[model samples]
Target: MRLFDYELSGNCYKVRFLLHALALPYERRAMNFHPGREHKAAWFIEHHHPRGQLPVLEDDGVSIPDAQAILVHLASRYDPAGQWYPDDPAIRARIAPWLAVADDLTGSAGAARLHDAFGYPLDIAACRRAARAVLRRLDDHLAEGASGGARWLAGTPVPTIADIACFPYVALAPEGGIALDAFPALRQWVGRFRRQPGFIGMAGIMAPQIGP
Candidate 1:
């Protein structure tokens, strides 16, 4: 198995975190997106994904793109007992909405911070506002016990890909100036994630609150 990923990307970190948690071993191929390494390369497009996105997973001859899709695939293949993803239809339904929120909050807010604060610097105030809104939503959700008293997002006894998917960006949000102190529940959740075995920090990133 091989994982093609960008070291600094939260999306890529999602896959890496899950794989490490599962004790799955694979060759890591780091891609350089800054110099258009992923975009300008024909081999990458043809063999991996034409979308030129980082965090492309190759298991044997099969290739999977999109962080959520990769999570599903990893859980299904590595954990068929549905520990990471429940088999019950109702549980699955409940789990699905959190994934959407994770994608929106973590994906959107993370990108906003990366582009505005680190990469290009466009409208820092707007980006910070958007990131704060997402954090507040997560704070409220966790306070409501959306995880059913479990420490993770999917209500599982252990952390699932759902938790893994959102951990990196949320943890590193402060580097983009999105404060975590306002979200106590979210902060506790991140603490639980860090204590888990085989956890790996996202490369070139810092959790201003958690301190990596």
Candidate 2:
């Protein structure tokens, strides 16, 4: 398996986190998405057409783009226990909506991060507003989940792709000038995610603890 990766991308980091959590060994083809803009190269566009995005996963002869889609693929393929992408309809009901929220994070918090960090052209104020709204909603949901004895977004016993999907950009929200100070439940959820086994951290994300 091969993953076309960019170090600073939250979308890519989600895939990387899952690969490690699943203990799946794969090769990484690092793309310079920042100052280099290698993802726009003719070769990459030719082969990995349709969507020239970071965190492209290749397994056998199949190519999967979109970070959320890759998370579903990796979980369905490598997770023998069927925990990450559960087989239950009730669980799926909870999971799918949260995954969409992850995309919302990309547009809001994510766009702001890109504009600030990578110089992507966007309305910074609008992005920050979107981010704050999303965070407020997420924080409320997480708090409700806690009351219902669910720590993860999917209300599962353990972390699922839903949690993985939503985490990266949320954790990196400060980089986008979106403060998390008011979202205590969300903050706790982030800390819990960091402590999950097989966790991997990227730039702006704290490294997992190595001690017992």
Candidate 3:
């Protein structure tokens, strides 16, 4: 398998974290997005994805584009320990909503901030408001539940893809000027995730510390 990714992208970091956690060895082909390298050529679009996005995963000639889809695929295929994803349908059903939340809050909002910080000139106020709203929802959810009440989002005894799905952006939000100090449980959760074996920090991103 060959994974084409950009190092600083949170979406790409999701796949990297999962793969590292599972100890899966695959070739990583880093791509440069700054100069529009991903959009310049037809090769990236025609063979990988028509959308010309980074973080494309190739396995047995099949290409997976979206980060979430790539994560699910990795968990299903390479996780021999069954730690990242559960086979139980009920568990999956419960975990699905949180994953969706991660996508919206972490993925969308995080990307918006990143674009703005890079001088892309997006609507900063709108993105900041949206990100704050999302974080409040997560903070409220964690505060309502007991600390370590559920081992993970799916009520499992260990971390799963859901945790991996959300960690990067939350940890790096300060780079985009989003503060997380008010979210105590979320902070604890991030610490716990960092202690997990095989965990890797999202490298090459500009993240500054925010006061708790």
- lDDT minimum window of 10 residues, candidate 1: 202-211
If ranked by lDDT, best first, what sequence of candidates would result? 2, 3, 1
Write the residue-wise lDDT of candidate 3 on 37-78 in tens digits.
Answer: 764478888888798886889988899988878888999898
Arrange candidates, best TM-score first.
2, 3, 1
Off by over 4 Å in 2: 208-212
Per-residue alpha-carbon lDDT of model 2 for 154-180, expressed as tens digits? 888898999999999999999998889
Which candidate leads the pack in lDDT?
A: 2
Model 1, range 94-180, lDDT digits (tens) per residue?
Answer: 677767766776555777767754575566677678778877877787777744675667666776667777777788787677778
In candidate 1, the residue pairs with backbone N, CA or C atoms under 3 Å apart (3 or more residues apart, or in different chains) clash, namely: none
The candidate with the higher TM-score, 1 or 2, is: 2
C-alpha RMSD for every candidate:
3.3, 1.4, 3.6
Please report the candidate that would top TM-score against the real structure.
Answer: 2
Candidates 2 and 3 compared: the better one by TM-score is 2
TM-score of structure candidate 3: 0.89
Hey, what RMSD does candidate 3 come out at? 3.6
